[model samples]
Target: MTNFDPAALPAAAFEPISELGPLSRERIKTRLDARGYNYAIDSDGDIGGRWDDHIFYFLLLGKDSEYLQVRGRWSRTLPASSLGQLLVLANEWNAGRIWPKAYVRTEENETLGVYCEHSVDYEPGLTDAQLDQHLGCAISTSLAFFSSLDEQFPEAVAAAKEEIARLTAEQQ
Candidate 1:
């Protein structure tokens, strides 16, 4: 894995996917569904929508706030592939902090990914440096999860990376 330093990344380069509007949503949903995710729009419409299957539930967010919340179920099977894709997509979406305190788990209930629900603190004096740090943390955590998956699952990881690159490129 490359040492991704958000500080080294150009501000223009790390464009947030949320700014892309509905098109971004469509693209993300399509990619997940193509990977065999059973996509669903949350009926309550509380935390945007969700794309889920027997494995993982990706809670999409619409705005930046401190008190974000998500309600869902964790799959008995670990959705490493889906989680990897979610991380890439969340990074693209500029999700400051992802929710649902716990999710990723091995068949034996061993946690393999960083699963936590916390605020992406935004304050008056927030700087680009701070934002970059947050982004770097999220990206690196996702990379770690991606690395944990078996090497044979290259297609899913590759596709997730490709989609992230494509979406990031479109923002430029």
Candidate 2:
């Protein structure tokens, strides 16, 4: 037998998943793949991908995988000294927006890590359109929050601009 490489297959090669019901890892993978997003499945089976430098994970959690969560970690970290600033930013985002529940956590490295999550129970299952809306809203809202960070903490994220510019130039 030959070594099977899943990555070699075309996006269209995956089985058409028209009959959507419950939210499962495969459904998430199919949606991501169909949308041409680059993602990876971890050893624990969590599906994750990067967008504009931020990292997001699509997960189904529960005894029957009855819950769907799209969690994101902001790419920037601030010194613990900026805890107040981080908290204010998180609170502002939370107050103004609804899709992502944004917050900041004190990391072991003496820095503050930002996170955003959108989760819902899918006990009754979901249609493909519903899944698409959830996934799209999760990502777009999270990115909007990240962009707000870039705006509010420009000094902390200045390097991100340069790096993104470099990446964009390289793509051209």
Candidate 3:
């Protein structure tokens, strides 16, 4: 066995956002809005936005936990038959990528939806720079993963569009 040295590891510092008060869900929304990205606060108080064909959302876990939940949804839903394939793809992504792990879930209409989620928790708190970096990383990773899904299965996207049109016409 090799000898371990605790001093070899660099110490991390927790820098709180002095200019801002307690980081709440509302504060997260305000900061995001100030950055000029268009977003909507849903009935559940989660903030969501659409960018480059991907729908992304963020939910503040809680002030005590200081955790931010970020998720990205593919605009299209795949057929039920594609669940196995989707699982395979998600597993490949989870194995290769560290942030924004992929998952598949069934929607109310029985369509399979692919999603990616990442959570960041600040021990003491977060600095403004840290918040900004986290936000940027979350959004970009979501958009990139969505694009990767599209590139991997173009047919699923096209089928989803057709299904959307059919559903819309039925509603009308």
Candidate 4:
């Protein structure tokens, strides 16, 4: 059996919703608005955007777990947008389906504000037999998704890696 040390892992960093920038935030808001979603932005830096029937919250962390929530229930299922796609890709990476290689890039045309790409890799302690059964289930689900969406999965994974790389480069 492999000895696992969760403590050796690095702490997860919280990415501020504001880091997406006003323009990006506005774009998301506008999209939801056009879809007839009810949302509001307050002085406290909280943004709640909703469409269909789902609501998601984006909050700014403070003394309280400040966050902004955007929620909506979809009348019909919808394809995941760029952001949604990235999120799924990130989840897959975290689950060990894909390597955690990603970078961010900004286009000169300004049409695409920021983009990312990610590679695939096998994660240790993630697939151990002794690991939680739920974890195995989650990873299996992710793998099944990638298997079913063969073509799209590679593209999405690549984009995730690119986005991560771009973000890292920008910091330097």
Top candidate by TM-score: 2
Lowest lDDT sum, 10 consecutive residues, model 2, at 13-22
Q: What are the per-residue Cα lDDT tens digits for candidate 4 across 1-104?
A: 87987776666533332222222344445554554647688776556643222233433332333222222111112133454554565455557644222222
lDDT, candidate 1, residue 48?
27
Q: Report the Cα lDDT for residue 128, model 4.
A: 24
lDDT of 1: 0.41
Off by over 4 Å in 1: 1-102, 105-119, 151-172
Compared with the true structure, model 2 gives a TM-score of: 0.80
TM-score of 3: 0.79
lDDT of 3 by residue, 1-172 (tens): 8788766666643333365445566667767876888888899878888887678888777648478878888898777888998899889888988888789999977888888888877656666666777788888887787888889889877886788799999999
Residue 21 deviation, candidate 3, in Å? 6.2
Runs in model 2 with CA error above 4 Å? 1-20, 159-172
Q: What is the TM-score of each candidate against the true structure?
A: 0.27, 0.80, 0.79, 0.23
Off by over 4 Å in 4: 1-131
Model 4 lowest lDDT segment of ten = 69-78
TM-score for candidate 1, please give it.
0.27
Which candidate order results from sorting by lDDT in descending order? 2, 3, 1, 4
Query: Candidate 3 local accuracy as lDDT?
Result: 0.79
**Compared with the true structure, what per-residue lDDT tens digits does model 2 show for residues 10-108?**
988876556548788988888888899999989998999999889999988888999999999998878899899888988988898777999899888
